[model samples]
Target: MSLHSMGLELVETVIYLTNTLICVILAVLVTDAWFRGDHKGSLLYWMIAAWVMFAADVLFASRPLLSPVVARILPTLLVTVGQAILLIGARVNSGQTKVTLVEPIGAVVLHAVLLTVFHFLAPESPLRRVSNGLIWATLAYLSYRGLRQSPPVFWRSYTAPAKAFMAHAIFHLVRTVLVLLPLSSTSEALNTFVAILGDLEVSFFMVALFVGLLLAHLKQRNEQLSSALAEVKTLSGLLPICAWCKKVRDDDGYWQQVDHYFRNHSKIRFSHGMCTDCADDFRKEAEKLQPSDL
Candidate 1:
């Protein structure tokens, strides 16, 4: 291999290494959140999609030793499925009701068929040029839709994820251009520079991801602190109580259910199923309902 190729290889290796580190950190956070049920607040499949893309990057970067067919096919399949899932997640999270699965799957399958044909019929040519275009086109379209129709909470509380999605789409678009553009012999310096710049882009993605997670963590912590502060109270003696109902009257002067009043006046939430009497009443009511409805 020439020095330029060697340099490219080294740079690619470093880029993949950085992605691997990011994957590890993301995996840890994802795993913990998944187990603890904290990620229930967000789209689980979208996070999985990011991990799949990370896997694809690792696979593609190892193409020198691994079979070229496997490298190409693996990333292509992953990028397709991952991006599709991510798009779906973004739509759902943003409260869009209409999403058709067939379009993305069909596009991916068609591209795979074309790529497989080209790999066998014209092995000398790189087919990723066309594949990248399709993927990026989809990404751009979805990113636009997501940004345009995003929820208020998505914009206010968790804006980073939205921005990350858009930024990712933009990067994929740039990748499409890089893959599609022809390289000239006279542009060797430019090619080298672009290669290094591409490596830097990967670094930028990692840093962005790290910053996103940090923001998420801080946002969560701030919310918790706010809640704690909101619930803190300085109570005085001889609080007003309802004479007949035995319910406490708060400073707001509203008569409330014992549990409801406590929950409103304090920080805790109620748990457990209905009591025996309530359960019995519910069963009797159910029995009285129409058989078809039941």
Candidate 2:
């Protein structure tokens, strides 16, 4: 191969290997999320998205074995559908959306139909490239928006993922614009450079995104545990109770009724009723006190 051809082959090899590695990492993350038993749906969808993108890379790399139409359309279709699903997953994780089978299933069907129409009706047209890019860009934008709008308690944790999604969206938008540019050797070279840069950005941000998600979930859980501990500590230590009154002394050295103490320290509620023994004792004491003592 010529020097130029060899350089291109090296770049393609690197992209392929990187994508394969990402797919493996994503699979492992998904498994970890499943074992953790939190955010499984979101993690599973993210994993599926990664697998779809990896499959697209595989298909594109094997273009030599495919017919012209299949080679032209299949990879792009996979990528479009993958991005849409990724957005849905991100939204669900951010609590801005809910998981449903219909959206992802519909996205797959829509991508396939669009690619089929583009292949037969307008082969090699900029419309096909533009449409694909636009769809991916839109989904990325939506994901960014959802992450940004996460609840305040979770907003800090989601910051990194939101920024990553924003970066991803920007890259796709740039790609869409590049697709609409006039074709020339110079433009093609620039487009190729942009495509490789976009891929690298995606790889970096995906790693950050998943790690951020895991950290955010752990942080939320930690906060919950801390709150529970604080509550438990409130009722701990030496609580002084009056020998005769049965009232408990609080941290401030103020005596409070037993029912009030428990209600303040915990979620316990009291029913105002004397026990049978206490009721009997009260009755006997009343009988002994009699009206004659007055």
Among the numbered candidates, top TM-score falls to: 2
Q: Please provide, for model 1 over 30-124, each residue's C-alpha lDDT reduced to its tens digit, 9 standing for 90 to 100.
A: 65655665565334754676677678777756877788788656666766766676666656656656755665677668767866876778754
Q: What CA RMSD would candidate 1 show? A: 7.8
* Cα misplacement distance, residue 229 of candidate 1 (Å): 6.3
Q: Compared to the true structure, candidate 1 yields what TM-score?
A: 0.64
The residue pairs in collision within model 1 are none
Q: lDDT of candidate 2 vs native?
A: 0.72
- TM-score of every model versus the real structure: 0.64, 0.72
lDDT score of residue 7 within candidate 2? 79
lDDT of 1 at 200: 63
lDDT of each: 0.63, 0.72
273 in model 2: Cα distance from truth in Å?
Answer: 11
Task: Output the number of the lDDT-best candidate.
Answer: 2
